[model samples]
Target: MTESDLIAALEDAGVHVVFLPYPKPGSYWHAHQLIVIDARLSSRWQRCTLAHEAVHAWYGHEGPCAPETEAWVDERAAGLLVTEQAYARAEWLHGPDVHAIADELDVTPWVIEAFQRTLRRVA
Candidate 1:
């Protein structure tokens, strides 16, 4: 889904999204049902961050997540943002370069990495 679609989904789920000058790329406050994205990030980063935070909200995380939770969130968010078909097509076109694949898919390298992890788990 697009950034707008993600925002709409969050709103529909009673979560609010806001852009602020945050130190981190994005954060989800479960208690407040709010997602805050660092206003300074580029659009690509913002979109990726939004997806990551949305997964946290979907899972109803209360505070800071543990490493395992963060990993799961990354995988889930990567799945939400990039489909397997698209990833495969990007890889076919761009080879195994993470940056090239990410550029082709219009997602962050982190998302690409997470997607790779997901693919590994499935395989």
Candidate 2:
């Protein structure tokens, strides 16, 4: 979906989103909320990152300066975008490789796998 569409989705879910300039430091900020994004990232990365971070807020995730936890956070965020249903449909409907599904969804292949894991976790 386009950035506007993504923003609209967040709004529907009752989250506020703002685009801001990236910090002087390097690296694209995926999202944070209000400060949801550092804003340096291109629009493409912006939407993907936004979806995940917004999910964090929704999930009320708490913590800081933890590597192992960051991986878990990444899964949760990715799960929000690459939802289980979407992943399954993409996998079954496409009837081919995972990369094709990722390409179709405009998300990373890891996202698709994470979505599957999320489904498994919830199920």
Candidate 3:
């Protein structure tokens, strides 16, 4: 989905999105019903961040970061941005290249790496 679509979906679910010049790419402040995404990130990166934060919100994830929580969020974020079908298509067209898959999907290479891992877990 496009950024606008994602924003609309979040708003529809009663979550608020805020763009700010934060040091991190994005954060989910569950207490305030707010999502803060860094304004300086590229559009694709912003989408990925949004997806990650959205997962946190959806799962009602809170408290200090833990290994399992971080891993779960990362996996969900990658799946959201790069679905199984999309990943397969990208791989077929890009020949197993992370950068190329990311380019095709409009997400960062880091996201693509996570996506690759997600694909592996499901295979």
Candidate 4:
């Protein structure tokens, strides 16, 4: 989905989406204040970052926590972005070509792989 699409979704849920167009030093998303997106990134990468950040907002991750909590948040965001049905369908259709699915989803290939692995362990 487009950034506007994601923004609209979040706004509908009562979250504000703000765009900060500058050099993408690193993707950062804060839950407490608002969703600040790095506009320098491609729309695809923006979508990935948006989903990841939104996961943080959804889970109410306010501050730094235990290492396990951080890991869970990151992996959970990846899984939520890729999603269970999407993951299963991608697995069935792509047959180990995760980068292809990541290309389609606008997420990093490694994120997809990790998300798939996380789901495997979870299930």
**Backbone atom clashes (below 3 Å) for every candidate:** 0, 3, 0, 0
lDDT of residue 109 for candidate 4: 76
| Number of the predicted model whose TM-score against the real structure is largest | 1
Model 1 over residues 1-123: C-alpha lDDT tens digits? 799999999999999999989998988889899999999999999999999999999889888879998989999999989999999999999999999999999999999999999999899
Q: For residue 49, what is the lDDT in candidate 2?
A: 72
Report the lDDT tens digits of candidate 4 across residue range 1-123: 455766777777677776687565123345344777777877667777777666667766665567777566658668656777877777787788888878766687756866876977978
Q: How far is 93's C-alpha from truth in model 3 (Å)? A: 2.2
Q: What would the C-alpha RMSD of candidate 1 be, to one decimal place?
A: 0.8
Name the runs in model 4 displaced over 4 angstroms.
22-32, 92-94
Tens digit of lDDT per residue, candidate 3, span 2-52? 678778878987889999899998998878878999999988889988988
lDDT of each: 0.94, 0.62, 0.84, 0.68
TM-score of each: 0.96, 0.57, 0.89, 0.69
| Candidate 2: residue 82 Cα off by (Å) | 3.0
- Number of the top lDDT candidate: 1
Q: Per-residue lDDT tens digits of candidate 2, residues 1-123?
A: 556766787677666777777562112223433425667876546766776665556555553426655567567767556655667678787875877897777776666666666667878
- For residue 67, model 1's alpha carbon misses the true position, in angstroms, by 0.8
Which residue pairs collide, candidate 1? none
State which candidate, 1 or 2, has the greater lDDT: 1
User: What lDDT score goes with residue 68 in model 2?
Assistant: 56
